[model samples]
Target chain A: MDQSRRFTQVPGKYFLIMKIKLELFGASRDLSNKDFLELNLKNKSSIKDLREKIINYVDQKFKGNENLRKIIETSAFCSEDNNIISENYQIDKDQKIGIIPPIGGG
Target chain B: MLHTKIVDLSKEKIKPENAEEFIASSKFGASIVFYGTVRENNENKKVTGITYDSHDDLVIKSFKEIYNEADQKLNIKEKSVYIEHVKGYVGLGEISIIIAVACPHRSEAYDLSRYIIEEIKKRSPIWKKEHYENKESEWLKGNPIQAN
Candidate 1:
């Protein structure tokens, strides 16, 4: 977990930006070709924001992979404690979050 | 005793007997063992092997959760369980997972075993990539994790 600071414009004021590390798995890893991704997000960003950021990142980097984007949309985020975090859950500190895609195991 | 492991093929392999031995108990009359294996073909494709990928820590955690759920839901008593899933390449006819359960009676033993496996499939953070004889591999589509 690491944090970096930046300034991003909000509706009336500027918000602090923080760096969050996302540990990718399965199809997300295959598409991104990276085990992890460092994303800059607004301080105290929600999981929804992270989802949007990831989808946006893929939309730009992969250019035309609709399926990959769809996978990210349905995927869920897991906390360091191995519990799935709700979309409304806010992130206020640095954490290594895991991106879990659809699972097929016995 | 509850035994759970994510067997890494490079270092070790899953043994069904080990699961059986762990769950064997004199207090239980019925013991059910389930072994999931890789087949030779799928959807008319010639399959060679399968590579299993998993979030190691989450997987073990999920297994414990499933076991606890099974114990309470099924009202199992004097029960013992053993669960092991593979984490690497498994060729055709090789064991990919093992689930063993021992309960006071046959009915609960069956129920507990089924519940554990089904829950694991839905809750565990694991994926399977199938390798075909055509030298092609594809990740099998699975149910997405529920994000509340």
Candidate 2:
């Protein structure tokens, strides 16, 4: 709803761990019932890392819903700016990820 | 320069006929309108309704790209195309999308109409969700095409 929530800061042992916010859309929103999530990932984390966290978040929240897991795996990742990003892409500060699940428009 | 009647889901209903009316001209002899309707069932399951969402900005951009692509591929001179998609809830037998293409010849109109719809499905950022009577919902099985 807010499009994205502000990042949360976590105090880490060596340094303050910054949060990487993820925006949800379509199936990702329905399955997780969350519009945004703040991951304790450091800057420069791979897009694949973000993917894993989304998958894991679905797992934890939805339990044994394999259908939802598949959706996340097959979804296309995009930056907050709406540019498509590959799984190998890196996460950067101020960059918010959006999970666009398989589309079904007629 | 492109034409679209795209409107968010609301009390206002989508009229596929609008595509034809908007593109109608004395010079063009043929106009084809394609309407995509919401069906009552999917995979033998009774689907009560459907909904759609998209990255708003990219959806508009995608439409522009699609319009340009169609114009180039068709070598469209006097011909023109129109697209309209309704987001949010849509009931059975309602139009989800409307595509219209006008050309001097009927054959070209048909092909352009088909091509526009096909490309929109494959290339647009719009996504659909199906709701079954049994309280189950699935995001339909197609990836949102990413434009490079």
Candidate 3:
């Protein structure tokens, strides 16, 4: 699913935090060594926001790994329909999203 | 028959005969079949195998899109195409992908086959990690995905 329905109360603000599921593929999967990653962000975030979070995550967890960071930066997010979503597209609900890196197939 | 498939090697192997049989017809004069297999060496590395990973649903969607794009670009309405790519580990000399096409002319068949494969390489969400003799592996670089 894209985001978990369970929301958390922000300490200062009243907005809920959404838990999102990002499916990894190709180099992204290889670098992360995971099939998918769960991210928590503010409700109604956009694909661009997700990208930043992923970059930050890679930076913190895989420090000095420029290759992984570059892959995440160059990647695009895909919706459940398998179409690449625009960076401005909002992610307000639960759904499984895919992180598409560069592709090489015969 | 015009189709695309993301084959799971553990469940079934890709067969050339199946593609040939599916594309066989009296109306078509030429058929082109391309099979990609694991090689023994690449970039000076003694390659042992390849692990192909893919987003199944997206790969199938990309295949359909590539086929449709091919049809529009080539203006070939009447054709038969069968495309399959493996989705798991493949050893040396094992088949990784197959693209079979049948058309009214040899040149069209060749062009169509070439176009489809090229587009799939750029559009499909599939990746390959090469396993080498030294037990090391690396994912090959590819074209970046563009937001649709």
Model 3, A83: alpha-carbon shift in Å?
1.2
Which pairs of residues collide in candidate 3?
A1-A95, A1-A96, A2-A95, A2-A96
Q: TM-score per model for chain B alone?
A: 0.95, 0.89, 0.96
- Interface RMSD (Å) of candidate 3: 0.9
In candidate 2, which residue pairs get closer than 3 Å at backbone N, Cα or C atoms, i.e. clash?
A103-B142
Ranked candidates (DockQ, high to low): 3, 1, 2
Where does candidate 3 stray beyond 4 Å? Answer: A1-11, A31-34
Native-referenced TM-scores of chain A, all candidate models: 0.85, 0.74, 0.85
Per-residue CA lDDT of model 1 for B1-148, tens digit only, reads 6898999999986877788789877988999999999999889999999999899999998888887776578767578999899988999999999999898899888888899988998889989989999899988888998865
Worst 10 residues of 3 chain A by lDDT: A1-10
True contacts kept of 1: 0.80
Candidate 3 fraction of reference contacts recovered: 0.94
The DockQ values of the predictions, listed in order, are: 0.73, 0.48, 0.83
CAPRI tier for the interface of model 3: high
Q: Say which prediction, candidate 2 or candidate 3, comes out ahead on lDDT.
A: 3
Docking class of 1: medium
Every model's TM-score: 0.92, 0.84, 0.93
Model 3 agreement with the true structure over B1-148: per-residue lDDT tens digits:
5778889998988888898998999999999999999999998999999999899998888888777877688898778999999999999998999999999999899999999888888888899989999988999888888885
